[model samples]
Target: MIAVLIILVSCCCFIFSTWYTMYKNRNLPPGPTPLPLIGNLLNIERGALVNSLMTLWKQFGPVYTLYFGSKPVIVICGYEAFKEALVDQNDAFGARGETPALDPFAKSRRIIFTNGERWKLMRTFTFKTLKDFGFGKKSFEGKIQEETRCVMEELRRSQGQPMNPARCFSYAFVNVLCSVIFGERFEYSDKRFSKLIGIVDDIFHTMCSIWGQEKNDPSSPFTSENLLYVLHSLFMGASDTVSTTLRHALLIFLKYPDAEDKVREEIDRVIGRDRLPRMDDRLNMPYTQAVMHEVQRFSDIAPLNGPHMVTKDVQFRGYFIPKGTNIYPLLCTVHRDPTQFATPYKFNPNHFLDEKGQFKRNDAWMPFSAGKRMCPGEYMARMEFFIALTTILQNFTLSSEKEFTEDEVAPKLAGFLNFPIQYELSFIPR
Candidate 1:
């Protein structure tokens, strides 16, 4: 009789606590009611995180709240909502929010995870260093051109036999970044380099994102640990985006051979078989540009994007989001916005092509994200993708033994990043 009374009292306390918590946060945007501890966990489907968030967007509209445990995360979706929060109201939403899965590991030391003053200093110093190293400029093309030559030779050795190009793509892309960071590039045969890449791969299979320095102050952000973490962030970011995009691009190319043929045709017409493609050449190659934009749009690489925090209390679309509230500016919604893309789900290059077949920009094509927290490597990544892909088409025809179905060609739309299914293809020399 005493044990039963204790259990009954515990249940009553739990009920009261939950009710009080819900009532306190009643002003937050409406969505599915959350449980006491594991708030909204049941609402999310297993192994389909991006899709689940998107479904919530449809149900609750663009701006709504979901609970992760007791903490409320304000999810901002669609192009208009994103623009308002990230661009227009940039300062309020500029701060980095807690990524609980990554918080322990990151410790807010790296540029990618920190907020306020430390973030500004890290970002400023890192961008200046990256610029000095020729990140987004024309001078950086030399490194890419040299890497492209090496990649082509590696492909030639494949002898038209089917092979997974993921490793080769990784080596080439990472080497360019390594050149910037370490002032050197590792050989493809370097065992230590390969092992290090493997470790980074394991971490990505596990969570993912980066930099800098003041002087000898105790409060300075320039410690050896900080520097190491910054390099770690750069390596992870550098290796992932271009390589993953290339993998998806190749898969899409195989799925649409006509698109591949057009890319090759344009390459031959403009760049010719004798020379490598240049950034200047991108201007005249409208179809190739359209294809690259479409690839990024359809691939939707970083779907959830990084979590952001509100620096101050703000009103958004008739919702009251408190200061320090975590925000999810869903990139998947922006890229897949039906109002923005003519065929949001399909791999249609025409979304970026005008009536005259010239390349046109879509405001919603935000694969790198937007505003103050926008990717620092946007310009470099754009150049890399353009040059690397144009170079590939300039030399080889992408061919696969197994034909990809429409579903296979579509983005997986799951997890932190969307990766294409593992498949082999031949780099049949043009």
Candidate 2:
């Protein structure tokens, strides 16, 4: 009886401490009450981060707070909140938050995760280097198209069989940057290139393991450790995101063959089958562009988005956000904002199209995010999208081994990325 009494007393104290923390942060945007130790973990199920926050959005308004294992984060839902925080108050909300999941890959030094002076320097240098290397230019697009020609031979080897195309897609995209970064693109079967591909295959895990081993080493471009980090950043930026997006595009094509037909129709009409699709061809092929945009919107890619930290203690949307607090812009919310898209839930290319059938851009469509930390690979990714998808569709008509079902095309947001489930594709030569 005495032991039971002590247990109850301990529980009461834990509850009191939790309540005190909330009391101190009473001015924070309202959210579900957090429990001690677990915080709001029980409130949010794993793999359903976006849907769970979206449910709370209905009750808590666009901007609200939620605790993940005692770390309170301000969740910005919808376009207005995202614009207000990330755009209007860019500096105050500019710092990149330390993400425990990506700290291994980010190292708090690379362009993706670093904040303030480091972020500014890395971003500036990266942009300059990319521009120098012809990113977003016809030269870069031509380079990507060259790589695409190489992969097309590999895809043809499948001979209408159900095989995974992710490896070839990844190799092509990585090699495109390999030439720009390493000054020489490797053959697909080269031993050194193959090993490099292996490392990038599971890059997030690889970097997580190798993150700090280079810390004591001198800071120079020639350092082997630093070289690895640069390669890792490039792979993270180029390979995985683009490969996953292209793979998703194929899955979408299989699921909605009519969408595929529309893309092919647009491609054949403008570029024709004789020549490979080019970035210059986008203006004449609005339907293909819209379909590609829709594929990305439907994929949701980096759903939660990389976390951003508050640069200074500031009040936003009538809530007091302390400096250094983590902020998740909930970009998936804006991407699926009903007010922004006519059919937010469906995989409709019309969302990115205007009445006249030209590809129209939407403010809420931030697949690569916005503001200070927007993806540096946005232009390259776009080029790859047009080139890679058009090339694949140009040579092959994709179909799934199994019948198309909603569960098949729908994303399994089990972990960090919003990607489709693994399904084989029959890349039938067109």
TM-score of each: 0.95, 0.90
Off by over 4 Å in 1: 23-25, 107-109, 208-214
lDDT of 1 by residue, 1-430 (tens): 9999999999989977975685465578888888777888999999888888899999999998888878889999999999999999999999998887876667533788888898897788678777778877776888889888999999999999999998998888889888766788888999988988887777766764122334567776666667777667777776778999999999999999999999989999998988888999989999999999999989999999999999998989888888999999999999989999888889999999999999999889899899999998888888889888988888888887798899988867444788888899998887
Whole-model alpha-carbon lDDT for candidate 2: 0.80
Clashes of each: 1, 0
Cα RMSD for candidates in order: 2.3, 3.8
Candidates in order have lDDT scores of 0.86, 0.80
Residue lDDT tens for model 2, 1-430: 9999999999999888876675455589998988767678888867667789899998999988888767788889999999899989999988888788666556523667666665565566666667777776777777888898999999888888999887788788889998876677889899988788886666643442223344564542233454455556777667678888888888888888999998888888888899988788898888888898888888888888878999899988777899999999988888888899888777899998999988998888889898887887788888887898998888888877687787778766746777678778888897
Q: What clash pairs does model 1 have?
A: 111-210
Worst 10 residues of 1 by lDDT: 207-216
Model 1 Cα RMSD, Å?
A: 2.3
